[model samples]
Target chain A: MRNYQEILDTLIDVSKHPLRQVKEFKARTGHKAIGCFPEYVPSELVYAAGMFPVGLWGGSVENSRAKEYVPAFCCYVLMSDLEYGLNGTYKDIDAVIIPSLCDTLKCLGQNFKVAVPSIKHIQFTYPQMRKIEAGVTFLESEYGRVLAALEEICGTKVTDKAISEAINVFNDNRRALRRFVGLASEHTDVITPVIRHAVIKSGFFMEKPQHTALVNELCDALSALPVSKKGKRVLLTGIMADDDAMLNILTDNGLAIAVDDLAQETRQFRYDVPSEGGSAMHRLAMWWQIFEGCSLAYDPEKKRIDMILEDVDKYDAKGVIVCMMKFCDPEEYDYPLLKDALEKKGVPCLYMEIDQKAEAQAQTRIQAFSEIL
Target chain B: MYTIGIDIGSTACKAVALKDGKEIVGSSIIQTGTGTSGPGRVYEDVFKAAGLMPEGVSRIVVTGYGRLTFEKADNQISELSCHAKGVHFLMPQARTIIDIGGQDAKALKLSPAGTLTGFVMNDKCAAGTGRFLDVMAKILEVDVGELAELSSRSTERISISNVCTVFAESEVISQLAAGKKREDIAAGIHMSVANRVAGLARRVGIEPDVVLTGGVAQNLGVIRAMSEILEMNILPAPMPQLTGALGAAIFAYDEAIKLK
Candidate 1:
């Protein structure tokens, strides 16, 4: 029997250094890797092109040069990514795909093109008028452009069958991840919040099918065990929760993440591509249209509150924690509204400001919030 | 029985002891000089003032930025929770709180019972904090404690719109070089901090009877600016620096009784 510790340790290492993982995947498989920035970017097209869709959720990098291109008010993730791209850290990527989701992202997309001249940037906008035929129609056209861009960069013709297969692989991967999140919370002793994040984040570095296989195995190992720990089960919502420091603090405070609405984690996989839709490209576009509840992705009706309330109930979570990303306009704008609605329902929510540096203040905040829970 | 709480802000450390969980027996506030020794020094100082032995304390709770490092604490709470708890205990009618400490500023809304309803903290910047004013005071060759008085005497208030502390400092220097009065520049700094904090308060939807705590609560200039901007009378805690420690002591007492 494979030890879960060994498996998780190996995966955590993979998730920690995505650039090295991408280079390794490229060297081992003799294939190219494409960069996908945070929030939403349809990686299925890249996967269908027989390439790795490497997630570029920013890290602790030197932001000195990034200031030359973008303002300091941008989110930490974008700043780090800009720093890497400008400094040639991401020079090896064949093409970078950016989803111009919010204001900062839109500016970053333009800056990336000018700064990283060597890499091809496949930029597309996700329609905010989703939930309507017009939105789907616009997104389908956008997907077509992205498909063409991928074909141009990869110098290979991607077929309908290949995309359909890629969609199936992603759907299965999403199911496994969705299942494993619940299992991780149940078996917090075995799968701490850090370990769970590692297991989920590693998927962005590997092929979708391979990720699915590993997650299924992890779920099996977790389910075979008893509830090894007891604590407050809470839902985490934010752009990203990849900070190991923050996760360790949560563990110390005895708060288990029952599930997350983080864009870097479950939020990326929540909506599976609909197979009943027209073409694989259409289905991929339909996936974006059907997606809801992210601070990004534009919901005029603000259904995220309902989704969060529903998630708390469904997961039997005691409360919600907002890993508030620093300088993220969309998330910042939604915070007051989200808090107001949560207050009305008498639900407890705590906001922790996340940034590049790990401050000692976060520990006290997390501990205090956990006490109330 | 005695209950103790220690608060470690970025600039200073505070210790407070409560007897029977009602009256504050004693409190001490001093700079967080160097390392692990600050908590111990403040602890001893508070104990000496109370004329009590530390061994008799029923429980000890710690809150603030350095609370996690205070190993002697029986319980640790967030500065946000501690501030709310302390203000609730100090001024029972305080439904909102604005606390400006060493590293950051926060505006927290509370229930009539003093429970924290919601809060908005400063972004990852030093502008809306005591540290921001300290740097500006140093630049102007003035003591930080005297900034409120200096600004109050300003004939005309200048505008310091930059939110970044480093930029704000440079802007202040240029303004001085551009023949701007130090008092007016000081007033601008106060307005800048006040506006930033007031924006945070509005985000949390300030309720009536707001209480102000932390080191900045003692600054009358900031208080005046906050009043003008928030358009509400912001009350200050009698000993704003020890509020977090007091709140922790309250929690320590409550938890101690429950355990017994």
Candidate 2:
């Protein structure tokens, strides 16, 4: 049986190597890109629409471009938008979707339309969920608008049969993703580092069909592998841990992130409100109602904190990690209370504020925190 | 020698030129950017109006929200320290300071020698800031600059209860729909902001001789309503916004002399 440490070490070695040629090759194709900013971005829809869905990670912290557009108060949201708009790193993207999660992104959308005039802009204007029908109708209208926009840009109309088929494929990918998550919980001795990297990369690289097959195969293969040494599991809470380098550092430090409550993935996959027997618009609205369970769709401050606790216990996490983006007010307000409550429940909680760029300091801090656990 | 202070706040820039600890020139006014330009640009406007070159300015101090952002400063001081200094400079008997700026409101306590004793700051929301008043004025279809005069003329006192500016704007419209006089609503908005500021003061315990500063200090209605709520006579410095800048300039002077 392959040792888990050996597998992780090999993966780390691969991650550290130069990949300029690989990235240059990918960029050479002039990919039809669609960028999604954080938690609940429905990559499935983007894929079904025949556009490469790229997760906009923004840029590094030093001399950040985000500070120019957004106030010093909203650091994280500004950085992500700045990465695409100010720096022009995501120049390949034809269009982008920004959800009205909080004031930060709302302001970013309002400002960016004026700041960057080249790209198509769509804001998923969220509805108050107190009224079910009204909320669904609002969501359906938004999805229809997005779909219509995507069809125009991509030059391909999405038939109902096409959407239903795409949903099935995405559902399979979700099931496979779930299996991988389950394996991580079971203390797997060996994880397909290729698949782990591919699953995340697919959000950037391939269209839906190719990514689904690649990820599904990896999960099926990993599930068949035997169990290894079970390390302390940790549940990460807060904005999607944007620091890839930091994640690598933490994994290297023997802190296996068995589960994470990323704003992006958790918000996207957790809810599946089927398009009921009503009109296509009604079905789309139903999908949004289900997706709204993720905090990115709405301000689920109290609910999300409680949900984090639930996930921690359900995953049997040894500790909780709350990764905050500097200048993010809502998370900052929610964090202290969550930290105190988690600590009270005898859970070791570590809070770290990261800038847009994940630097060596973040890695060092995560390494240090992981050592404590 | 004049000790000049400048505060590049969120919404306005303030400048004060003090000679022998007596104010010689001072001004508090709107930022020319109208809301888009940075705090540094606002300070440039302040300096331009004062007709003072950056090099000619001696013992320069800076304070307030954009204090750190403006690098061309002799020294930077916290708004708390500057508020204390401004209050001490204006009214030597002042023991408390209440400030409402663009997006934040703070209440500070001062020792006899102008040392900061303690303070409470509301940095989270715009509930008690001048922005709240501006929003209320927009709903009333009046210029925000004229709000103080309009509010002061009201004989009937109406209550504006909503804390959130979005909700408060809606409430103000509803009050208008209900045939409430604009002056009554304007006065009520002042009372609401004053009530919030008073709550902030209550956190650190209101002290006597309270000095009010920041852009909102120019609003007579807010000062009058706050005075009534706290039951203390509020004293405002000649150029309230410049207190932070003056505080920053003072720190710069101290540093320069120490180096000498």
Candidate 3:
């Protein structure tokens, strides 16, 4: 079996230095990289178009130039994205695909052209009424537009067969990640919060097949080890939990993330595209229709609450930590309802505001939450 | 057996010593906290006041923002759990606790048995904390302690609408420029803090027999405003600043017993 520590270290290095990974991928594959913005931009289209797809979830960069483009109150993720673009951090990416999932993201799409200008920008809107037939058609057409833009950039027509194969690759990767997360929960002593996040996050910068193989190997290694006694388990739900310092606070307090519903992590892979849908693009769009329990996904029934409670029960979580991204309106709106439902069920919830630029003062709160648990 | 608890908060360092985990032996409060000499100073002061040396103490538990930095602590607990324990000991009937410390404000829900059920805290903002009051008092050119008396004299209500501390300070200056009474502004400042804190309390779905702790609990003006807003009697902890330290001491005592 492959050494899980070596695999984890490799994934962590990729997560920590995404630009280096991007450079290496470009040099190794000899293909252009396409940037995909957060919450939901389909990367399969880029993969099918014979190009690389990279996730643009922003970085911990200082924001002097981005402040002039976007307002100061915009979410830190988008601000850092703009900061990276303006600062030439994402200059190598040929084009960026931005989805209008929230108001700030819509604004970021418009601002990207003015701020960056060097890289081409492709923007699409996800249908909010996704369960309807027309909504699925609309999303398919949106994905088609994004694909056409990618084809123009790459100068290669993306075939349906290629798209189908790309979906298979992504689906396999998602399954491997789900397995890894479940196994990681049973092995917290081996998988600290930082290491768990790095392993998942490295997928953003890696090819899907490569990430799947590494994750599968790591999972095998983890399963071969004896199941250690579990520590304090908690569920994290929000836009993202990407900050290393904040995650360290959780580890310092002996809190292990049993599971997470974060947009940047598990939310991307909880559901896979149906292989038997009408078309490859339609199947990809149908994946969104079936997706539930996300703040940005427009579920009026508030399935996220039920989903969170179920995960808490299933994983035997002692509490739920809402890693509320600062200035993230969708996540902010979902918090009160989530908190009430959790309280009704007697599940302790901790609301933590996550800011990429701010110092982590989460130690006191996490320690206190551990005590409560 | 003697046990000690130390709370090194944002602006203050407090310590409490307990005899056999029940009787209060000694306590100390220093005006400074982390990034200064406050932790060590308070530790020495508590031992001195207790008429005991460091060697006599069985265990040392620390809480608050600076808890991790206090090297002598046997273990560190969160101020929320500590505050709940301390308040439960002082007021057994308390079901909700609103603590406004130097930098943050938190509202904690408690079971009838004094266990922490839920909690909500202000996020990286000073508007609902003791630091807000200190800034307002400086802007008003009055001692922070005098705000309670000044607010009591207000004949008319003044509203401070801004939730940001810097913006609120500017608004307070504008109010003073408009010849508003200092007492009315003082009342308005207290009401602003009370509103912010009460919103946090409501998040946890406040239960009755609510008690207030932290250094800000010592301010009657805030207490009166909070009571009016929450529409519940708010009992002040007997020694507001020492509650966290006291709770840490209780935890220390419990741990010592377990070790034995």
Q: For each candidate, report its DockQ versus the true two-chain complex.
A: 0.45, 0.02, 0.74
- DockQ of predicted candidate 1: 0.45
lDDT of each: 0.86, 0.65, 0.91
**Against the true chain A, what TM-score does chain A of candidate 3 give?**
0.98
Candidate 1: where are CA atoms >4 Å away?
A128-138, A152-155, B32-37, B139-142, B149-155, B167-189
What are the per-residue Cα lDDT tens digits for candidate 1 across B1-260?
Answer: 89988898888999899999999888898887326578789978988878888688899998888776778889778878888888888889999899999888988888887887777777668988999999999999999999999998999979997478999998999999999999999999999999888988887788889878999999999999999888888888888988889999998999999999
Name the top TM-score candidate: 3
Give lDDT tens digits, candidate 2, residues B1-260: 45566676677766665554454554444563223454555456556666666666667766665655566666656666776766676678888888888777878767788876555566346899988988888889999889989987898989887468888888899999999989999999999999999998986557788888888888999999988998888887766766776665565555566766
Better of 1 and 3 by TM-score: 3
Query: In candidate 1, residue B51 scores what lDDT?
Result: 83
Residue B101 miss distance in model 2 (angstroms): 35
Q: Is the docking of candidate 3 incorrect, acceptable, medium or high quality?
A: medium
Report the error of model 3 at residue B257, Å. 0.6
Q: On TM-score, who's better, 1 or 2?
A: 1
- Per model, kept true contacts as a fraction are 0.43, 0.00, 0.86
True lDDT of residue A85, candidate 1: 89
Which window of ten consecutive residues has the lowest lDDT sum in model 1 chain B?
B31-40
**Local accuracy of candidate 3 as per-residue lDDT tens digits, A82-105:** 999998999788899999999999
Q: Name model 3 segments beyond 4 Å from true.
A: A357-360
